[model samples]
Target chain A: MDLLIQIIFGLLTALIIGAAMMVVTVRNIIHAALWLIASFFGVAALYLLLEAEFIAVVQVLVYIGAISILILFAIMLTRHISGEGERLLTRHWWAAAVVALGLFGAVLLPTLAGNAWGIPLPTGPAGTPEPLSGVEELGRGFVSEFLLHFEVAGVLLTVALIGAIVIAFEERSRRRRVLTLAEEHTLNQRQKASAERAAAAADMAD
Target chain B: MRDVIEQIINTTFGWGWPGWAISLIGYLIVAAILFLIAPFQMLFLTLFERRAIARMQDRVGPNRVGPEGAWQPLADGVKIFTKEDIVPDSADRWVHLIAPCVVVAPTMFMFAVVPWGPGMVPVDMNIGLLFFFAISSVSAVGLMMAGWASNNKFALIGAMRAVAQMVSYEIPAVLSLLSIVLITGSLSLVDLIAYQGGLFISSSDVAGVPDLGLGWFIFTPVGFLAFIAFFIAALAEGERTPFDIPEADSEIVAGYMTEYSGMKFGLFYLAQYVLNFLLCAITSVIFFGGWQGPGVGWLYAQAITPANPGGGWIFNVLAGALGVFYFLAKTYGFFFVMVWIRGAYPRLRIDQLMDFGWKFLIPLTLVNIFGATIWVALTKWGAAEGLAIVEGWSPMLRWAVAFVVTLALNLGAYLFLARIFAESQAERLRVDDEVLERLTNVA
Candidate 1:
């Protein structure tokens, strides 16, 4: 049973890592986003295997739902650069392939050889065990054991939110300057054209 | 339940090699069978939703496939498979290709945690309920990926809104479940069901009964409120009507799935229907008594005992079969309710949705939890003090109380709305008549 679990976990992890790598390597931004999602799913499954169900759900909700969509929105807004063209990347394909293969070989060898040095496996059950780490358990644990860290995380979130607002305000001022500059140039051009037309009319009358 | 499966398999096939290997093989075989049937089940669910909604709207839906368009999904599947797979010229190629796969995988993974029948679950963990929540939430990522990868502005916007909506609504869903968890004092889905039984009566009383029947969670007022919240949240989770702004057909043209075609599109469609089934199943387990029918326990014992003359693989198979049927019925009933609502109501605006979740649902659910906890605490304290506050009530009286409470609440709600809107009683009555006429097919 342990071996089977190990194998399943190993396979799932490999899929996740491979997908994550593909997300960066793939030419298409959309495809890269998709692969990243696959990686998130791999991590979620790992969380389930570890019986950290709440964390797994949180991982999915935050990373997959929020981050991926934000990335997509950014991609959409940058319409001029987002379009696909053949050969966006230019690299020595053979050398890159060889390096990738060599890296995989190096990692695989140690994983295969280090089997004997395995950590102590969970003895009770494959999934969640008795005195289950439920929401209530986590809640109690939060107030007792990890209260400081939880409070710090909350404080960090607030700081980040405030920083975002300040940055946004700065960006707003910068955008106003750029907009006024463009408006001034257009207005000057229009006035010059009108002056030229008036002078031509006077010369015709003379 | 999983232990029972291990024991049964070990006793019968103990002479084999390692017990673990045999169990692994057994589980894989079961998974294989379920995988084969899952697609068909998804297709049927779609048809059922379509037909039920059509009936609610007094229209005939998809009557061209097979008998009553039963084979429509199959035909649709074939069409999707044969269609051209478009790789958007401007889209992120890798993310686009991986998006549907991402969506499908989490949905499939969720099924692994769901128990449809007695001793039929693939994995019966102590954190089964948590497992369900975790796996179900992962689909949001897939959806987001799909939206992002599409490279369509509409898709991107829709995905963002959907993510926000799902995340906010998830709070109420979890809180509602938390209330139930408090009552049951367990996270395991099976244990929670057992606890509900133990709460209402003694073990001896249960033993005297046929299936060790429990008072269903829906019977209590607090439980009923939780059930409503769960149902609404689930509809939002599944991107169903009223909460389906993320995929509003007239506005966004299928939202995140806009750029998808061929089998890729089919996968998303398949996932949506399966998700509907999954949500219904979860609601049934959490809110309703799962597979808790009359004489079910007795039949289970009779089918499993060695001394019983008729006991064999056949009886065991029958038990499993019945279990599956009961589970399917419960899931379908919930799905039908969703379909009915979809036909009856209009979609909500995104802002309205966010407000509904954070403003109304969260506070309402918190109130429900407080009420349930106080009720439980009072009952326990009373028992300890030898003053019975609630022992038993006549069924008729209980039903009457329910009716009077509901009527009074409805009247209060109506009066409040009238006051707030500054509408006269005559105008309010007119609006009520119009709604009633619409419901009764007179308008």
Candidate 2:
């Protein structure tokens, strides 16, 4: 059983690394996003191997299900810019490589020496693991022991939501499209006149 | 099925067969069965939808193809298979080729956690409900792939709308299910069903209750709201009428599937019906009890399991048949409702779809979660159970209080949210008209 698990883990790790590499190296932006989903799926598989089924499902739910699709949507929406045969990487490829490698070393060096690198199952698969008792434990942990952190995170997300709405929200009037060139010209003129009026009002008040 | 197979293997063969091997064989059988079931369901549903909708329209459906269009889907399969598989010259050929498979694969994965009868689940995953929804969401990416890769304007537009509609409606779907999860306190589909075993009241809410298999969540206020929200969201997810903006046939020319022909189109059609079937099944599982009906609980209790080996094989057959019958009845009933709605309602516009999902359903489900919490507290919590206020109340009284409170709360939330949604929508349209009038210099 141990050997079987190790084999699966190794395969998943290989998939993760390969997909991550492809995510950066792939020329097609959409393909890169798809590779990112593969990498996310590999991580989810690892979480399942750890018997953290809830986390594994969440990883897939949030990453492959939601985030990857969002990324794909963003990429597809900008298909005019991210057209085929375009170079995704910038000119400073070496700089990015150096930073990436440096970060990898900084993170990987300690992980290679630590207990996490080559550990057997901490507990044999005998008793029902508490975390795997379904979503209740996750909820309890969030609401009780990690209550402070949970509230902080909730507040943080709320702030982010409000911030996103503020930043991304467009004025209602601007969404309407003028049909003819004359109508468009008139709308622009009206906008300029309003801008001038507001400027003048500000100057007079000052 | 796995247990029966393993038992046969253990008895017939020596104990030499490894545990993993037996398990693998069992899973393989389940997968083969599920794959077969998906296509079969697709075939049945296509005919079912056509016949039901046709009847609603005062017309006799396709009865020519082998006894009431029973074999129509087979004819469709042959036709689609023989049709030339055309890929547009400008299309991303690889993505186009893989998109149908991608769409179909998740629907297949969905069968893993669905419980058809007692002990009929392929996988009893701890987070089964989460797994089901998560796997379902993966298909949205495939739909986007179909749209983006097709290189056709209609296809891309269809794909974009598909993804947008899916992602938006998913919020309400999950939120509504979350309320049920909060009440049941379990994400497992079987657990959810087991919780609904009393006569007209959940067994979990009232102790020592007889398991008559009549207790369904839909009878409760929380469940009713959830059922409404979820079915609507399911409509959006399955791209049924009223939420079929993504694939509005008249508008976008088959939407994301425009570029595909032959088995590829057949695959999308198969994926769709399979998804609809699963969604309907899950809706029944969550709101209407999936396999739980009159006598099902009692029958299953007497069925032959390891704990109840004295029970007869006859009981097993009876229980399994009854459970599956109830499950299929509820599921097909939902599908019939889908057909009914399709016949009754016109498709929603894309903007209207988004507005309904985000503005109305999301808020309603969110409020329903609060209602669920209140119900749980009132019914389950006590002084002995760490509550001060409900210390003296009897269990029956507490249940009644919870029911009344939640009913009032849910009704208020629904009416409040509906009014706000309608007003906001009207306001939004008014703004749109104002802007349009200014720009066009015409009414």
Candidate 3:
């Protein structure tokens, strides 16, 4: 079982790294978004390997399902979807490399030195190993123990949503709305009726 | 399944197969069976929909292929297979080739968590419902890829509408299911079914109740509302007619599928019908009690379970057959309703679709969730949960009160929302007319 898990972990790691690289190097903006989704899926699989099923499913649902689709929509709506002829590297590439290397080292050094690796599973009263994360326990913690944090996070998200709507809201008076075919027909009919009435009034005057 | 296989191999045959090997074989067999079942369902559903819809339109549908046109899908499959595969001149070759597989694979994976019969789930994951929906959303990416890779304007428009509709409706769909999850307090499909095993109320809700296999969630007001919303959302998600704007034949020439032909088009068709089947199956499973009908539950109790290993194996077979019968009946019943809807209603405009999903269905489901919470508090809670008023009441009396309260609340909310929504729509129309009149006068 351990061997199987290790093998899966190794494969997932490779997939994550490969997809991440593709995200940066892929010429098409849409393809880069696709690669990003693949990278997100790999992370979700890693979560599953760690026995965090709830988190894994949420990662797929929120990131891959919602966020990546949003990103793709934005990319598609833009002018250059294929990103052909775009420069792969900016002029200050070395500066970016320095920051990237420093961030990677900062993340890796702690993990390499940390003593918390390979911790044993917590046991229940019956001496059986408990799941690393259970859905029910997580729910209980959110509502009871972490109630304030949960509410704050929810409020923050709601605020962000409202802010987005406000920014995107167009003024009704200033907006130029396109009429549907039915509406256009109604407008045309009204104009033709008024025109005929004007002609009839002029004829009566004559 | 692993247990059964181990018993046969290690005990009956005295082969002493290892546990992991037995489990692996069991999973492989289950996966193979599911793969077979998925495509067969797609084939049967295509024929079923055509025949049913044709009957609605007062016409005979392909009755010459086989008896009642049973082999029609097979003939169609052969035609599609023989047709030349075509890729557009400027299409992205690799993405175009891979998109169909991406779309079809998730529908197959969804078979993993669906409970076909009692004790017949493939994986029975703790988060089965969540896993199902999550995997389903992955197909949206595939649709986008298909549209973009095709390099066709109509295909791109169709894909955009498809993704937008799916993303919007999924909110209401998941929210409606959330109410059920809140009431049941579990996401496992099996647990959801097990909770519905009494007369009108669940056996889990009230003890000592008879298991007549009639404890469907639709009997309750909250469940009824959720079922209505979820079914509507399911129609949108499956791209069935009335919500099939994504592929409106009159509009954008088959949507994202406009650029594909031959086997590729066939794959898209298969994915669609398979998805529709799954949506129906899940609807039945969550609301109508999958595999939980008369005589099946009683027989299953007497079968060769771990608790009663000495029981006859005949009961197991009997229970499984009856359970599967009930499940399929409910599922096909839903598919028929989908066809009936397609025949009855014209396709909704895109704006109307969005308005219905966001303004009407989402609010209705949000209120339903509140009712579900109240039901839980009344039926399950006592002084320990700070509901001291319900502490002295009997379970049946509390249940009655909860049902009555929730029914009133839900019905009232529905009527109020409908009135407001109608008024808002009418007001918008009036405003549009006024604007048109003003513009006419200016001219």
Candidate 4:
């Protein structure tokens, strides 16, 4: 059973990491968004395996629900310019890849050395293992122990609210001003045309 | 029976068939169920809704199906299936094909988390609530896909409105639940229910005769307001009645479903009802104290007989079955209410819906959470202080105060929402006027 879990975890981790990379590296922004969703799903599955039900759900909610759609909408709005061409890679692709590779090696080489690296593994998984009872224990901890952090999250949300309002209001105003100006321009043109018609009628009468 | 036969096969063969083999079996099972039971359920629900709404409207409905319209949905299904599977020449073939799948799959996946009974669930994930939210949200992507893929102007516009509505509403939905989770402290649906077992009810001491009351999350005021918040969110999520702007049949001509047909269209239609059912079920579980009953233990005990003396398993099964029935009944009740509202209320404009979600639901939910947390903490403190005196009075008083506060806030929120809705509608009218003028000039 342990071995089965291990294999599943290993496969999941690889898939998750690969998908994470693909999200950034993919040429098509839409495809990239889809890849990011795959990565999020992979992470959610990992959270499930770890028995972090709430976190997993939050991950899926934020990433897939809010973030992915936001990205999709952004992509759609910008589609006229970017089109379908997967031009996600910046000018320094090789540099980025080399840096990534170096960072991977730095972590992987020592990890491959295993015991020689001298990092201690506890009798159980490091950090507070998520309670098997799920939300009940998590709730208790959140309310009593991490109450501070939980409250901070509320503050963060407030900030988000303020930011959303500002942006929305700004956008609304900009659209309104432009629309009013355009209306005025059209009205002016129509008036000019009528005046010209009146002058032509007078000429005909004369 | 066939179920016994399948059980034998499953036990004997085990679940370790090759991935493809297992998947093939699962697929076949799902397809069979969908092909067989889905149509029946869809038909029944349709008839049920029609009859229910008709009663609400004080009229007899669908009495011709099969002695009071029993077979109406079946006839409807048959008609839909035999209808031509029209594909617009201008539509993108692949995306169009996949759109219904996207819409349908998420709704279907939501059932996996719902506990119909102890072992009756398909996939009992710990993050079941989250899973439901995640999967349901993806339906918007499907809507967008359907809209974009169709290449029809109406479909595209409808899809945009849908995507916007869903995205805006999603936050308030999560935030509303976040408040509940704060009090309950767990994400597991089972755990959430368990927390509510005792807290769901209190003895009302009217003349010293302890009145055993309804066990529900909505009993408390914050819980009650939260229930309303959750209900509105669920309604919008399911695209019911006032919130059913996505498929505003009168306006967009089936909205994003403009180009879909055949089995694919069937999938989307099935998903719509399934999602509707799920939103109701989920609401029941979260706010109505799922599976809690009076003398549930006694009910289980009564299930055991002389022939089944050591039938602890039987009792377990009975209890689970009872829970399933209760859950389903509550869900159906909610669905009936939704249908009733649909028959009664006018559809909301897209801007109105968004304003309701963001300007109203979001702010109210946040305030509800703030008030709830403080209220819970204060009540707990009171219980601690008046440990001896507050023993009998604790649940009742706590609940009463919570109930009053929640009701007040809900009313306030509604008024606030009305104002916002009015303002946004006026703004939208202004925009519409500009657009109309431009169109007239261009013409």
Best by lDDT: 3
Deviation (Å) of B208 in candidate 1: 9.3
Instruction: Look at candidate 2 and tell me the lDDT of residue A162.
Output: 97
- Candidate 2 A-chain TM? 0.70
Over all chains combined, what TM-score does candidate 2 have? 0.91
- Candidates 1 and 4 compared: the better one by TM-score is 4
Instruction: Itemize residue pairs with steric clashes in candidate 3.
Output: none
Q: B1-443 in candidate 1: lDDT tens per residue? A: 33456666667766545666666677787788768777988888888888877888888999998899999878878888999999778786766887788678777777776766555677776667766776666667667777877879888777777777777788889888887776666777776554444223322213332235455677666677789888999999888998999989888898998999999999988888888888998898777766645444445666754456476666667766776776678888998888888988999977668867876677767766775565444333344556454346443343344434533443454345446444443564585455434433421
Fraction of reference contacts reproduced per prediction?
Answer: 0.36, 0.69, 0.64, 0.44
For TM-score, the strongest prediction is: 3
Worst 10 residues of 4 chain B by lDDT: B204-213
Per-residue lDDT of candidate 4, residues B1-443 (tens digit): 23334555567766534444455566567556544644465667878998988888899999986888887877877888898888899887877887888788787777667756433455556667777788788788788889887989788877888888777777788888888776665566776665555434533211222222234667766677778888888888777889988889888888888778776778888888888887888888888766655544344555544444555666666777777777778888898889878988999877668767877788888888886775555445444555454345645565566566656776687688778777877887897677646644654
What lDDT tens digits, residue by residue, belong to model 3 across residues B1-443?
88879989999999987788899999999999988988888899999999999999999988998898889999999999999999999999998999898899899999999998888899988899999999999999999999999999999999999999999999999999999999999999999999899988888888878998878899888899999999999999999999999999999999999999999999999999999999999999999999988888899998998888888899999999999999999999999999999999999999899999999999999999999999999999999999899999988898899999999999999999999999988987798778888888986
Q: Give the TM-score comparing model 4 with the true structure, all chains together.
A: 0.76
Q: Least accurate stretch of 10 residues (summed lDDT) in model 2 chain B? A: B434-443
| Native-referenced TM-scores of chain A, all candidate models | 0.62, 0.70, 0.80, 0.73
How are the candidates ranked when ordered by DockQ, highest leading?
A: 3, 2, 4, 1
Give the lDDT ranking, best first.
3, 2, 4, 1
Q: How far is candidate 1 from the true structure (C-alpha RMSD, Å)?
A: 11.2
- State the lDDT of candidate 2 residue by residue for A1-206, as single tens digits: 88999999999999999999999888888888878888998999998888878888889899988888878877765677765566666899899999989999988988887865566765786775555445777788998899999999999989988998899787765655534456567667777777788899999999
Pitting candidate 1 against candidate 2, the one with the higher TM-score is 2
Give the 10-residue window scoring lowest on summed lDDT in candidate 4 chain A: A171-180
Q: In angstroms, how far off is A101's CA in candidate 3?
A: 2.0
